[model samples]
Target chain A: MEQRLGLEASIAIAEVVCRCDVDIVAAYPITPQTHVVEHLSELVADGELDAAFVPVESEHSAMSVCCGTAAVGARTFTSTAAQGLALMHEILFIASALRLPIVMAVANRSLSGPISIWNDHSDVMTERDVGWVQIFAENAQEAADLTIWSFRLAEDRRVSLPVMVNFDGFILTHTIEPMLMPDKEMVQAFLPPWEPLLKLDVDEPISMGPVGIPDIYTETKQVQQHLLTQAYGPIVETLNEFAQHFKRTYKPIETYRSDDAEVLLCTMGALSETAMEVVDRRRKQGQKVGLVRIRLWRPFPFEDLYRAVGNVPVLGVMDRAISFGGPVGPVASEIKAAFYHREQRPKIVEFIAGLGGRDVPLSDFGRMFDSLYTTGETGKIPAPTIIGLRE
Target chain B: MATQSAKPKWTELAVGTAITVPGSARQNRTGDWRSSRPIWNHEECIRCGVCVIFCPEGCIHFDQDQPGYPSADLEYCKGCGICAHECPTACITTQEEEE
Candidate 1:
């Protein structure tokens, strides 16, 4: 009834999008993400998928083209990684602000200064406030699932917001894995043809992206924020609907072995799965350590995260990106802020790991759990540990 | 006059409430910024419709009820006078707005 293939995650994700029957795709390729657009172009050329593959000169034009195509009520898709996603920064906010419902796959990569192209969360972390619903994938199958579901969640009339699906560069994007490929009829039954809420039809004209004057600017922004916050309900609903049709379960937060565990390690992107392995190994050694894999990064899933870490005294938040001299890393800082008004908040320890595409071994995760337990026992948060640093 | 317009609360406004109506910007009274206004003369005008083509704001249209006549919607025409300049018959002229 289904096809299982040893396909690279990028190709697999692109195949899922092709099945979604997108109307237009415009993308500029960057390392570890190029295979996705390359395959999509092949599909379009071969007439396997009836869609327009616009060849843009740069990532800015890529996103701008997506905006133009989406404004016309066309189902649009694009993929980029690292610097390319950064280059689309100006239009990224505009895409969400205009509510274009464009879906993108960002192969998570480290940023420059030293000019390295590799896996990390620095790119997406730098864009945390870009107003798009962001989600991370921990493995090849998850990458395939989320890329398909991004279109569903984004185009939902209730949400009508752009979505960014982040999968780790090389770690997940380049790996070949056996993915459960949903057939065409199955996808069609799962996702209906997108009915646009608003469009650029000449017969029924409407203005879009007109200047927001001082009188209405604040209210416009308030409504946009409200929509993003309200979108969480529909996001969960669509995921449930997706599971019913495809039979693969997904949650905002995926927890592993946190039941009655004293200390919890939390992570995002591909390293989350590795952290779970370490948690199991540490548990065998008589340590009460477990993990919380944060799948939903934006619309921050505060309630689900808090529930997953329920009654755990301490949390080691592993952030692949740094905030540069801030008291804690980005994910760690957000966790603390989420706990600020809670009745019983766990003591959060910032663990900055895997910057600039450096290897983050299971040993580092184990060490982080050890430090978290010690700090909780001593009742003192350690001065933000930079794990696996040469220092 | 500005205060007469209704301000929508964020909760009341639906998601994606963009200003989408074509030509709706004319309602904002941008014509109030006019330094000059164009006067149209019917006598020397050839009905070539050249002025309609050159209008910068695209606010010019011919009224079918008034034949040989191009008219401007005074509410939106910024009075830039490109229509007057492009008039072959020199039937239109720009006059300064009175304070």
Candidate 2:
């Protein structure tokens, strides 16, 4: 049965993970992500969920314990944001390399110089090449749903790799919303018991992380990369399977009223929902604008992204984080490269907004569409622009 | 700049390929890199097991028939001379490998 409840997104994500019957959860506390593990610990303490919630001293140890549990064929989980995720950077590569299907909730936060614990893509973007199957959730319900889906997809025989479920820090993690949380039996039907590809056992002990020594280092990485690339099919299949079970459908690149759109706005994470509202308001005013939200970030969903833009004459890609002194922004640069080989492509306008938990007002989104429409009419390309910057 | 002609065939490891040996490092002989070998002076030995405790490689085993005299297994030992340095009796000596 689907239960509708108003709860913080972090708690909702924990409840779903509980229903999934994760074997172990190990984490360290950091802002915007603390509530996730706290709730999981509460559930475990109350005996409502039977699992070992190991509280480690640092995020680095948290991730290491998670990898240890996963290597021993336990369904393991961990959560972190910003600096905490950065601390786990070294182990992040090993988790994927060892093919440990450990699920991590990265409540995305910005890097600090100003020491702000705020929402941005800077954290997960830093781990873009860590080889985990990564997906971004735009809202609380999506966050909850994806947490369950991650384990199913990550542990799939064809894709025995770690998965990162990234949702915007504070924006979604702290916000309370009416969420349809699935029950245990329903989730059980969707995900089966854990079947690990490799495990540490006395009877059948196997070696992991030996000296690669140049002769096989490249081959090892080649195999890891190839497995991830081939995982694209299994990803789609699992999403389809989830939809059939829960009646909640998801797409890699979701389109909003783009059928007749001349200009398109693209984004990821929680901001995409805000972008949708702006697109709706502009559409009501007959602006012919639409929105595209990227959910699957890893294997990049290139084909779906290309199909979603669909020759829209002007495309405005909104990035919540900066690539800093690089071309446009991360998302915009990737979009441009995606369309580089195509003859008929849209004139792309890049917008960097909503860094460090700052709100990007609906009016700012309006101004961005105006700039994109102007670029379409004048055939003059604008420099990669920053909106909502204080003068 | 130098380039190798052959590359790893990426197609071979499609989905479930693992780059690991599993269970044992017996296939690898790590002792070949040792510059010096530890030699035992049986006459000066005090059976305090100080050499056994100080050997970083833990390759030394007590020769029970010789009444608690510890000896080194050279196959896995990368001679660091920690046993000789820590031996209270000055019984163990490090000699340069002849080859």
The DockQ of each candidate is 0.33, 0.19
Leading candidate by DockQ: 1
Cα lDDT tens digits for candidate 2, A206-264 = 55554555655677787777788889999999999989988999988999988889889
Clashing pairs in 1: A206-B20, A206-B21, A207-B19, A207-B20, A207-B21
- Candidate 1 regions exceeding 4 Å error are B1-5, B12-15, B31-99
Pairs that collide, model 2: A207-B22, A207-B23
Q: Write the per-residue lDDT of candidate 1 for residues B23-97, one digit (tens) a residue.
A: 655468778788888878888877788988889887788883376588887777898999899899899999898
Distance from true location, Cα of B42 in model 2, Å? 15
Per-residue CA lDDT of candidate 1, range A252-346, in tens? 99998999889998989889888888988988999878889899988999999989999888988988888886755898889999999999988
**TM-score: model 2 vs. ground truth:** 0.87
Our model 1 lands, by Cα RMSD against the true structure, at 4.6
Which ten-residue region of model 2 chain A has the weakest summed lDDT? A207-216
Cα-based TM-score, every candidate: 0.87, 0.87
Report the CAPRI category for model 2.
incorrect
